[model samples]
Target: MVVIHDGYFTDVEGCIKENWFQIDSLLAKQILCRFSLPFNKLAIFTLYNNCVHLSAICILINLFHIYILTRKALRTTSPIYILLTAIAMIDIVSLSYDIHTEIVEVYKVFKVCYSKETDYTIILLNNIMEFIRNYSRRCSTWLSFSIALIRTLIVKYPLNPKLEILSKPKIAFYIIPTILILSAPIHFMDIYKYQIVFYDENFKCTQFPSYTTLYYGSILSDYYEQDDVWLWKLNRTIDAVISKFIPCILFPIVTYLLVIEIRLADERRKKLNQSSIAEKDSKNTTKLVLFLTLPFFLGELPIGLILLTKPIDKLREAIGFSLFTEGIEKFFSVVLSATTATHMIVCVFMSSQYRESALSFIRCGVKFKSQNS
Candidate 1:
């Protein structure tokens, strides 16, 4: 191994001091060789495999969820159910898009069906799907917060019609559109932030690129771009606020308020000796709100806080882009997928109305199959 320092070929380990820490070339080589697998391949492989399994399960369960939710008994029950259905549908679309992007990535990463020039159309479609999935995740986040706040308000003020406007599907007809409009810009810039650079088919990505090895496409993102640094920072600031800061801050406060209201509601029930089935259902609905909203908050809270910390110069400079930020993003993407998956189970376990509807749907399905048979 050759070690070059300050325009001089040296075999010494003493001059390898960088900033605060000093590391020998042997150690550095060892570090690089230990993992062996290139990050580009590792990140994509891990994300692709996990997303395939998790997204498949989430899509199937959410399809069943939407079916059960649209039952006549549950459809008109409340706007909360409407929101739940929207979340489920978006989850399906998002996961499908994720799968689409990964499929293209398999071609891009593993160098399958190579051509003279890079497949811009395929790569662009992959980027579009990535952005759309991101937007869907954000919309899901905001919708979760909306439901939490609405359920809390309805519980806190049981008789306030104006405040409960959002709790009604008719009154809040624009909510979904509003969320889509607001969160659309967050990923718009990201589309232009990356593009495929490595295109040559015969050119080995590394010394000898084969299966389970170096990356095929090496696209640089905005964080690596040196031009217009201020603009990137400004855009990232806005993204952090819209996509991370506000929702993360408000979700916990809303959760606390919702939990408090649930307890107070229980106390009210005890005081009134309200043992009626309707009162029992009301209590269950309140708990359902907690169950639905809390998962997204918990799943996203860690990553949100970490992303928020990117603005801090010291921390960001200390931990460079790919290893820390990219890894975290991939991990949390799966976390969000898993969180959405739990919604089906959450609805089934907590909402008695949903349980009844699910049973009815199951019976209808079995009867129809028997008749067809």
Candidate 2:
């Protein structure tokens, strides 16, 4: 019995020495760990693999849709056509990055092997992906806002020649480039905000310290106490407000005004007993804008809110609770990806122009195949 007690005591001492008693730390440490074989591994692999495949498929379909739309735009010289094409192009690029990131992650899990050189590549890709993801997201939201704002102007000032000029394809050429240029630099700041660190024999990219120094004559202070930390947090808050929340708020307001304008136009047309071609075209464009923006608002709002409210300390604290939180965060990421793919699918189904373009492309392919046969 004495020997048994001695052995048990030694085991407990060893566990304490190894820090296994720190359950919170253990859970936190496991947050980003690759899932082990059979169940967990299979589940994550399936989830990522499916997302990659679906996103790729949607991207290809959208590319075809863009080609058709561009050809139509050349003929019509319509600003709405130009904007739709630009949106499709952005979606394709964003989806490509999504697929690439998923592929790299899945490879990391299955192989469990990476070198220092590979670490640099991983870090670079991660930074690029982060920049593109944020840039594309903001661009999409802004483009939607532009559409709503322009439509509102058209409805409210139907006789304003200046507003009419702004709706031309020539103006879209300038507006699209301006939006791209504006949305890019803010997101590019992410390149400096993160760094790659070695963990579990693999390099992982994570946020760098917001401030390298605290102050003179002080024991190294906690990160949260740093002025730079709050500044960075505030920057993120402002970004979320501008890129996500404002657009969300404005979308509904502008859309409401659009509905009223449409009703007013319909009433005016009834009294005149003649609907001008421009009025019909404006109504159709409004329908397209509604279809495009509504899904984006619904699908992206949860993600934006999550980003705004996520606890900054969760990643730093090696705690068991963090595992649950991290898991929830990852689940949200999957939902976001699913929603992104759904947006393309929704476009194909809801937008008559996109659907017709896709169908026409398919028919052309069938005809070419028959001719070859």
Candidate 3:
């Protein structure tokens, strides 16, 4: 969502990331009335200032993550690496989209692009970025879940030939596409929910006197028919169930199983007084997946809770007046951007192969710099 001139358009629409909510309808009217200059600054800082730096850092980190995973040692270690490589790529795209929208908002906020007429293409372009951001963010969420599930299965059944398909790195070639295909349907609803409209007659911007007319994109209730409203609500519900709540639930369960299995494996190693490289690799993989899922699980839990209340009629009524959803939703953008940022650190600490390669990568950079100097 882009914020320009005294307008707040769009919100954290889904559980994993944002979809689209507009400023001209539903909660927007109340927000516009209650939140003025100070609040707008707060909203601005909350969404833009926080996300820009964090998102940029994460985008760079995710690039490194994708590159580091390409090392033959790390790549051959587990299929989780392949899935992780896919997740890192998505994270980079998602975080870059986050920064792009924030930059647009910053430009629109301080700069006067005065227009007596509506600019449909501007917000439409923002809508396209929102579409890609939400889609890639969802892909990251599902792939993280896939990693948890796959790693659990591989760790638990270390000798099952039935699970052999999952152990192959090439399976990610299949899994990534499957996730992209399956996670796509909900994002198609973006174009229908919001559109750019000219608010010339009723435009009110007391804070900014540079322009008399305001052309902003918002989710207008008037744009929806009765059936369309129901469809929109249904889509949100389905998205919450699939995107938000399910992973929040599954991550913990799979994490618990991984911990139990790894603990048991460690005890077995101690008893045997012997540890094979394969066994060591298995434990390390468990640790990597364990650390990997933590951020997603913690990040998604509160979002899932907010989504749980969205369907309740009483809470829905209160949401119009309450800034609870607004603050949390904007904060979610930063959180989503920072999700993959932690993975690199986790890898350096937990996964031996990644640690070695990461050191090697750093050394190569230093050596190159020395030669250039």
Best by TM-score: 3
Question: Per-residue lDDT tens digits of candidate 1, residues 1-373?
Answer: 1221221112123223331112246565444323322442344456645578778888899999999888776767777888888899888888998678557667766765454345546766766777777778788888878788888888899878787675566544577778878777666777666656544445554434454213235364656365545555666676767777788889889989888988888898889987777767777777788888767765577667666666555544532232345455566667778888788798888887787777767787453221100
Each prediction's whole-model lDDT (CA) = 0.67, 0.60, 0.69
Candidate 2 segments whose C-alpha is farther than 4 A from its true place: 1-50, 73-75, 105-114, 198-228, 276-278, 311-359, 365-373
| Tens digit per residue, CA lDDT, model 2, 288-366 | 6677667666645655664565436443243322332334444455555445445456555545555555566768745
Q: In model 3, how large is the Cα lDDT of residue 1?
A: 24
- Candidate 3: the clashing residue pairs are 22-219
The Cα RMSD of model 2 versus the native structure comes to: 10.6
Steric clash pairs (candidate 2)? none
lDDT of 1: 0.67
Report the lDDT tens digits of candidate 3 across residue range 1-373.
2224332323323211221222336466444444432343464466656667778877888888888999997687577888888888887777777677677666667755544343455566767787787778778889999998988888788789999888888878889999999987876765576656655545555556555335564463444435546655665677677888888888889989988888877887799898677776677777778888888865676666666666555544443323445555556655656677888888877877777777778888443221100
Candidate achieving higher TM-score, 2 or 3? 3
- Model 1 residue 180 CA deviation in Å: 1.5
Error of 3 at 176 (Å): 0.5
Q: Model 1 — which ten-residue stretch has the worst lDDT?
A: 1-10
Report the candidate with higher lDDT, 1 versus 2: 1
Candidate 1: where are CA atoms >4 Å away? 1-49, 105-111, 116-118, 164-167, 195-228, 311-322, 365-373
On the 0 to 100 scale, the lDDT of residue 264 in model 1 is 89
User: Quick one: best lDDT, which candidate?
Assistant: 3
Candidate 3, which segments miss by more than 4 Å at Cα? 1-44, 47-49, 106-111, 114-118, 201-213, 221-228, 270-272, 319-321, 365-373
RMSD of each: 7.2, 10.6, 8.1
